[model samples]
Target chain A: MGVRVQEGDFDLAVELADFGRGAGGIVTFTGVARNNDAGNLQYMEIEHYPAMTQSAIEAIANEARSRWDLCDLLIIHRHGRLAPGARIMMVATASAHRADAFAAAEFLMDYLKSRAPFWKKEVTSDSAEWVAAKEADEKALDRW
Target chain B: MIDVVYFAWVRERIGLPRESVETDATTVAELIDELSKREERYALAFSDRGAIRAAVDQTLVDLDAPLKGAREVAFFPPMTGG
Candidate 1:
């Protein structure tokens, strides 16, 4: 298990391959930046309460582990300013079977999106706005 | 004693991000009540109690859950994490 909050990008393919180890399956989910109708988003500034963020993430990871027979997992979420098209976060899971791997990866992502402490401030061409919690995000958690 | 933290709009309403308080409460609800009585700012910050979510020692916890042995408690809006 690993949680990274940084400005650098990640290589999901390499991450998945490494996580696979001797496992039979690996599933990875990558969340990318998207252009919103609000305008051209120059960048997104992410803020998080350090201790709380880590604890929340670890709790999610623990839940994932308990639900799946996984070999390893990786969660990398970036903080600070990020331009459009940049990677926002990635979750990868490896397991002895495809079903467990797939479900676990999705579960981790869903929980991370809804439960983590990080918040985003979108910097549009005209002005900056704090991204509110989307209803869809809360709904995503119900799938688990 | 616990270190309670507020973030984003919660902090904006409460007027501070961090504070230390000693309490005899065992659950988050009691703590919230105590905090809401502190000042108008806290009252406004905790006005819509349902809109706020909490974490004990950084783990997401139900408001009615016991806070025994917790070192930190945090209140904020529903997470918008990615």
Candidate 2:
């Protein structure tokens, strides 16, 4: 039952430790802003259909559960305006073993990147553009 | 009745982000046809059907998939989530 939409930054170490209660291992991943300096991105805005966004995230969480034996999971993604060096999303997983925890965390991120409904719009100095879906993201999901 | 939603470029193309419509269709494709008839904006939004993707009841679905009891439907471009 760990789903959150927040504007503030998150601490992955704290979240992983908290979810690790009663578990043998905990793994976490945080997606940070990249320096697409060539793109000249001054800022980015993420927008989503509220209800659909939540449902899609939950579905991804359920898919992770089916693929791995886990104790608990957490996901938090920020929306609205964001700048370079800002955190975009985080995933934390706890499991009976380190392998399961690590794999599940990776799986969750791959799925979230491809399947979730969020869209990103980049505001550059010269112009604004909508981010396009990458073929790599689709291929990432096919591995699972 | 189902609430159909659009987002990002799809919303811009269709001139709206959401709408409620009553439909008798049993599949998402059929629903798209019904919506395309409503206005030019919808027609353009759905013109390149291959570029559009759909979800029924919050689950990603193929266009031919049945919408027998779906309460909500969404149409958008291929996901750019990250």
Candidate 3:
């Protein structure tokens, strides 16, 4: 379980340089900050419960590894102010088969999106609002 | 005294991120009731309890959940993480 909650940017190349040695398949997902349809976004600020963030990610990663025969998993989520096109976070999973890797990656993504104790607030020149939890996101968990 | 904390608009409405709360409330819901009676902002923040989520000692819990010797309590809206 390699879960990092940081304010600094991470190097994808360096992170995956030796991600999974024996695993035949590897899947990755990256989320980047973007603008809303109404305005030009200045930045996004992510706030997370410091005490629970790490343990929550570790629990999710552990659950994914248990259900799938995953070799390794990595989760990195960034906080503080981030500009548009800046990376918000990334998730990677590795397994012996493509299906396991893909499934585990999606599982981690869904759980992180809905259950993690992090919140996002989008700031524009005119207004700022906390990003609300989408109904679809909560429904996405039904598949798991 | 429990260290109560708020996040996002919950904090904005209450105008504080954290505070030392003196209380005899045995459950999270009771704590909310106590706080809401103290100020209008707390009432506004806890008005829509369905939209709020509680955490005791950093673990997510329901409002009906017991305090259970908790050192910290957090209240926030449903998460929007990725």
| Winning model by TM-score | 3
Indicate which candidate wins on DockQ.
3
A best-first ranking of the candidates according to their TM-score comes to: 3, 2, 1
- Which of 2 and 3 is ahead in TM-score? 3
Models 1 onward score TM values of 0.86, 0.89, 0.98
Candidate 2 lDDT tens digits, A48-96: 7677788789888998999899998999988888898889998889999
> Which ten-residue region of model 1 chain A has the weakest summed lDDT?
A12-21
Ranking by DockQ: 3, 2, 1
Q: List-wise, what DockQ does each model earn? A: 0.71, 0.73, 0.88
DockQ of 2: 0.73
- Model 1: TM-score for chain B: 0.96
> Taking the tens digit of each residue's C-alpha lDDT, what string does model 3 give over A1-144?
499999999889999999977999999999999877775999999998888889888888889988999898899999999999999999999889999999999999999998899999999998899999999999999999
Question: What does candidate 1's lDDT look like per residue over B28-65, in tens digits?
Answer: 99999999998999999899987889988878888998
Residue B35 CA displacement from its true place in model 2, Å: 2.2
Reported per model, the fraction of native interface contacts reproduced equals 0.82, 0.73, 0.86
Per-prediction tally of clashes: 0, 0, 0
Clashes of 3: 0
